[model samples]
Target: MTAFMEPFRIKSVEPIAFPTAAERRAALEAAGYNLFKIDADQITIDLLTDSGTGAMSAAQWSALLSGDESYAGARSFRRFESVVRDLTGFAEVLPVHQGRAAERLVLSALLKPGQASVSNTHFDTTRAHVELAGGKAVDLPAPDGGNIDLVRLRASFATEDVACVVLTVTNNGLGGKPVLMENIRATRAICDEFGVPLTLDAARFAENAYLITELEPEFTGHSPRKVAELMFRSADIIWASLKKDGIANIGGLVALNDPDLAARCRLELIAYEGFPTYGGLAGRDLDALAQGLLEVTEPSYLRYRAESARWFGEALRAVGMPVVEPVGLHAVYIDAGELLPGRNLPANALLAELYLEGGIRASELGTLAFGRVDPAGGPDIPSARELVRFCLPRRVYTRSHLEYVVEAAAAVVKRAEAIPGYRIVHQDPVMRHFTARLAPML
Candidate 1:
């Protein structure tokens, strides 16, 4: 196989430091063995998350120089809004601090008490926001990664007051799989029948569009941008974090054609985030976002991004690691429970094992992230899979780095059988993965 090369050249570098096993052990203990709590300085190969971790390109940095800092009508905001409009074909764009902020704003406008907001799967924050606002975030089961259970979607609309039907284009919570365009069209048709609005949690829409261009024969010859424009037609509103496929460090926006809905969202955006123009972001952020919007869907860049992810996932699988079958666009999820047998062994143990083996830090996605804890904070509901996720940041890390990660995985495999289960000592009811404290069960 030809080596997957990054399409861009590096302009600068940051030195990484490795910690000794003894030091890592101490760090893990200090962090309550929760990998999320471990300091980045001690992590040799930090793969905890892809959010805001990607290195900015030289052009993005250059665009920052021309940023207009005016509070009300920055030229940077105009460029950002215009670029987003051209790509999404939505008439209105309201910027926000990040994707969840956009989600919150849209939900605030669309949802009422006892209303239901449905999706393929709600990522951590989306669910929290929905529940916090006195609404339910209902996740419909999908048999195949691309196909949603239409029966479930219709059932959600039928049983309760359906506020909006949400489709996460590259479903984030469940292995980053792309939703098929046909399913999306079908969803829109269902929403139309129910008189409910259809929105997109489109953080990875560009990546999903690229997958459609590559996999679907109906769109065989389309570019990612064109595919994205076509896909946006299926949703009444689109929300995305600029951090993901946007290739920016921070920023998010909601795009919609509905005048009343857009006005409602903008009012909420100003009350919570900021002015519609900058939206709690600096003018430089808008400039970078404008540049990122243009660069993200370039056909060459999309192909390289997809191929590079496949290269990483395939490389690990080659070493006998049990990864999620069809590789996700941004991350590789290792089946930790399968990696280490015995129902007694827990998924959270993989974090400490991988860190100790090679100073590699990966996020625990299975039980530690999704498991529900009771009133006393012990695990009440166990999650289905035990997954350890390594999310690749865009325009960062190369084949060489991935090879090191594979070596880390190999090292974890050596002592996998010895790894033990864990119990959560303390956790928040919502989005507990980030702040949950766990201790290895003896």
Candidate 2:
């Protein structure tokens, strides 16, 4: 393999903080041990999320100046729409502030009370939106990787009123694993058999396509853009958080073929978000997103993106940390269960330790993020996997920064047994992990 190098040069730089361990400890305590609550300035490396945290390119910055600020029928929106239509082959496109907003609009329109929206695995926000719309969220993740359990999926359609089947490419909820193209085709066939609309939660679509080219021999010569187009074509509806693959700071979209469903979503958009064209964002954001969509499909950038995460994952594994196999494109997930065996809330414990070790903040995708509290006063049910995700932002950070992270993680691993478990003291009814307060268990 060729040596890994960043595809783009650093045209600008942002200085990062190096808070003392004592200061980080204080910050962690003050924030109730939740990484999301910590301030950005207090963090040296913020791996809390990749959503909308990436740096934009020089071309994207230039596009921002060309934005038309019209309230309706904006030229910027038209350009953005055209780019999306060309890429995804969807006729009706509606812009939104972010991915979750798109989810709210689409799911609210399509889902009836007690209806189900099935997926390989629903990310936290997507699941929340489904339930908020008075629909049940059912996850049917394959035992391996990020594909739906085809046998179980077929069975689900036979028994439940499935509103839609959503396939999250490079499934975020399952350690950012790539979904196989063959799996997608088989899923499409099953959805067709059941007359269910197949939706692609394609936030990381480009990364998924790129990985497909690498992993699937039949798709060896396909460009990332072509692979992405094929993947999009398989879905009847698509929603994306441009924050990920769009390479933009803020934007999302819903694209579909159904006119009636689009109309329903448009009504919701006008009432809640801005006009259908602009949604809740300024015309400048639309323009920037248009350019970002074009740039993101470049093979060079995708290759670098995939390899960087893989490199980091391999490095972490070398240091006695068990990382999720087949390291994903956007993040490297550490198996917190293996790292801190028998410790309650092991992923949460590792999250705190990483912060104190190097002022590095990361998200816990294990029990805290996905576990469910027993309503009948029994023990909490843990997530299928106890993992901590180190989500790398696009066009930000370098190999040197990653090396520093590896070193910091190694320090924590050396004394992993010393880490303590935690108990949640306060949490919201839904998506509790975002704001949950926790205390270390003695």
Candidate 3:
């Protein structure tokens, strides 16, 4: 393979502050050993998440100046809507402040008490919104749900009282794996059979499309944009996090062919967010998002976006770090269970040590994020996977940053056998990993 180069140059630079281990240790202790609680300034290489932490392109910045803020009739809104319509082919477009807000609006409009919703796997916010709307959210991952037969599973749901169905492209909480177009078409067919609407949490649509283009050999001739159009064909509605593959810092949108549902969400937007045009954001944000939708689908941009992630994941694996196979687009999931099977430690040991060793902050993407516990109140349910996620923000880090993380993993691996686990002393009932307090266990 030819040596990879970033598609763009760093026209500007922001100096990052590097904190000493002592500072990081105190910060971790004060923050209850939760990486989420660590302040931005304390983190040396912030891999905690890829959301809204990316660097924007010069074009995006230029679009910001072109923003025309006029309450309801903004030129920025027109451009944003036009871009979304062209990509999604959705007749109705309603802009929201972020992805979760789009999910909330859709769920609020479509779901009701005692209804059922299904996904391959629902992320925290998506599931919360479903339950908040009085629906029971169910996950039926192809293997995890006790059967590899998705047809049977779909049949089961169709026979029951199903309200809505959503498929998260590149399942976020589960190592950012992209869902195949075959699976998407199958899900859409099932939703159609039951007269249910199928929508997508398409936060990483462009990256997902790139994977489809690269890995699915039959699609070899298709560009990423064409692949996206193919994928969008199966959905009734599509909602996306502009923070992800949209190539922007912050924003999201809900677009669909159904005018009535779009009108209803617009009403919800007026009540909860702002006018349908702004959606609780400045017009400049819309301009950036519009430009992002266009840029993200460019073949060059998508190629670099994908190549960078594979490089990061491969670097870690090269040092014997057991990263998730076929590394996904946005992050690499270190298989902590495989790395330290003899140590009897949770993924946190790897997480904390990564910080203590190199000030590189990752996340516990497995049992911790999902709030799993053993049957008899022991350590988190020792499933087949225990992942420590290192997210790569788009265009934010250089190749050297990934090298630094690999070195940290190398140091952590050399001492993996002797490292002790940690016990969670305090946790919230929901999404506990974010605020949970931990103490060392030797």
Best by TM-score: 2
Best-to-worst ranking by TM-score: 2, 1, 3
Give each model's whole-structure lDDT. 0.84, 0.92, 0.82
Give the residue spans of candidate 2 off by over 4 A: none
**Per-residue lDDT of 417 in model 1:** 70
Tens-digit lDDT track of model 2 for 70-152 = 99999999999999999999999999999999999889988999999999998999999999999999999998768999999
lDDT of 3 by residue, 168-216 (tens): 8887766777788777777777777778898888999998888788767
Candidate 1 Cα outliers beyond 4 Å, as residue runs: 1-3, 341-345, 374-379
User: Candidate 1: deviation at residue 297, Å?
Assistant: 0.5
Separate clash counts for every candidate: 0, 0, 0
**Candidate 3 — what's its lDDT?**
0.82
Candidate number with the higher lDDT (2 or 3): 2
lDDT winner among the candidates?
2
lDDT of 2: 0.92
